[model samples]
Target: MEHAKPLLNYIRKHVTLSEEEEVFLCSKIDYRKYLKGQYILQQGDISTTQCFILSGCTKMFFVDNDGQEHIVMFSIEDWWTSDLGSFVSQTPSDFNVQCLEASEVIQFPYETIESLFEGIPKLERFFRKIIEQAFVASQKRIIQNFSLSAKERYQLFHSKYPQIEQRIPQYMLASYLGFTKEFLSKVKKELLKP
Candidate 1:
């Protein structure tokens, strides 16, 4: 009930849902809890459900041939997390979605979502907009990686996700910033300097 507002806000940003429609949407979702390090979606597995963060954080990452994990995206409250490329296209996932902390989420399976959308065409538009936003975010991250220096990237990350540094490990943050731990520490110190 209390979680309804953020979910409603998230949906209404794309489409207005009547009370009946909101209730129908809520009925399609179920609350889920996950422990830190739990995998919501693993590479090579197909994700069948979409997760909305009611609280806590999750990261979607990929392991390179050298066995290094590169962070692709992070999801926190009001954000949606799903391997849409796999979930919608029915292909194996290239990345893993892992809970970064003990977390609570609202999970909606594909079938339920489809049913809800059939009754509410606007819901389809809402989810489409979410995918569009995710694509834009991915493009921005790609542009940053191609053009920004490691220190500048770290600064941009800090400005983008102030909570992630507090919640995630230094090594993981280093990986996300495309630097070694020592280098990231040096950069961090420089960032803190006057």
Candidate 2:
């Protein structure tokens, strides 16, 4: 019931749901509490569940051949996260999803989601819209990487996730922005100038 509110509100943003539908959906949701640095999904593991963050933060990242971690995205409260490629296809994931802070998430297993879609067709539209938004965000990040200066990228990131900036480690933030920690500090100093 407590976890239902956030998930219900998020879904309702993209689709209208009746009370019965809401109750049914909530019944299938499972909650998990993750400690900071704990992994939700690991590279090469199959992701069996999609999660909605009820509280705290998570980072989706991958280790490159050089053994460097590359952050693909971060999710905070009210955001959904999963290795969609793995969840949908039942294949190994290419990314690792880890908690950045002590976090609570509501999870929907892949089979449960499929069942929901089969029973509630409108839910499909809701998920489609969610995917569309994620795709657009990914495209924007790609464009920013190509077209924006490091400072500009930092500014964009700061503006979009001001709260997150203060919470995550500086080194992790630097990784997300594709810069070294020292470089990010320099950029911050420049931004602070009168």
Candidate 3:
């Protein structure tokens, strides 16, 4: 019950849910915990659930043929993290979602989500709004990757997500910012200089 508060609050931000609806929704959710370095979803597996982070952090990324990791996104408390494509299409995921810390998440299985939409009509709109926001953020990130210099990107990312920047390792942050660790060190040094 306590674990559901964050998700309920998040839902209420976009739409109102009556107590009954909230109870129905919670009935379908599964609260799960993962150890640091454990995978929530791995490449080649179909995503059957959508997760809402209750506590801790996760990284979503893919490994290229050359075995280089390209981070797609990071999620922390009150954030949703999942392979939306795979969950929707019932296909293999190209990405892996792994815990960066021991994490607690609320999982709504695909079937449960389908039922929730039917049981709680407002849920569809709430989900749509969140997905739309995520999509817009993703598109902006794509544009930034092409147009922003590495240093500029790093600065923007750091300013926006200082907590995440502090929590993650230098190499992971460097990879997310699309630069080498050495280059990141150089960038930080340049920033420190007048």
Candidate 4:
């Protein structure tokens, strides 16, 4: 189906799948669409499915005790998103994953994904690599937050994901970088100066 290609391509990048394995994987996944402002997963709910973006963007964030929304990450096409802790443990999620644009995703239900590893042994290796990469990225972000200045962080984010800056709002981007909106504006202004 149309929704399967991106995910298959992504999986191929990590591990090769046989034709039978590909068909088996596709049969187990569900293709879904979300409208702008709709939530794929919400805070306080168990994240039973992991969504792999086929198109559009989403932001994963949580509301603090004061009701402030703190963005954790913004995801676009080709990214896999879910509350990892909640999905893995079958516990309530601490974050909300909301679509920022009309979007399509391939949903891999937790049980189905687990079962796939048994039927298609290579999938276990693929998933393990995906988790390891995600963990490493999380570690890198923590280090950067502590060591990099706001301006430096902004520059690095921009350089790495130039496309994302154009898709998301400034305030959301600022939040992901651990900077206040006003601070982000000042940083942008400073960068623009000769």
* TM-scores for every predicted model: 0.92, 0.97, 0.99, 0.98
Cα lDDT tens digits for candidate 2, 100-146: 99999999898799789877789999989988998999899999999
**Against the unseen true structure, what C-alpha lDDT does each candidate score?**
0.86, 0.92, 0.95, 0.93
Model 2 lDDT, residue 114, Cα: 79
**Candidate 1 — which pairs collide?**
none
Q: Per lDDT, what order, best first?
A: 3, 4, 2, 1
Minimal lDDT window, size 10, model 2: 1-10
Q: After superposition, how far is residue 193 of candidate 1 from its true place, in Å?
A: 2.9
RMSD (Cα, Å) of candidate 2?
1.0
Candidate 4 has its poorest 10 consecutive residues by lDDT at 1-10
Q: Write the per-residue lDDT of candidate 1 for residues 9-90, one digit (tens) a residue.
A: 8777778888998887777788888999899899999888899998889998999899988887788888888888888887
Candidate 3 local distance difference test against the native: 0.95
For 1-194, candidate 3 gives per-residue lDDT tens digits of 78899999989888999999999999999999999999999999999999999999999999999999999899999999999999999999999999999999999999888899999999999999989999999999999999999889999998999999988999999999898999999999999998
TM-score computed on alpha carbons, candidate 2: 0.97
Quote the positional error of residue 5 for candidate 1 in Å: 4.1
Indicate whether candidate 1 or candidate 2 has the larger lDDT: 2
- lDDT for predicted candidate 4 compared with the true structure: 0.93
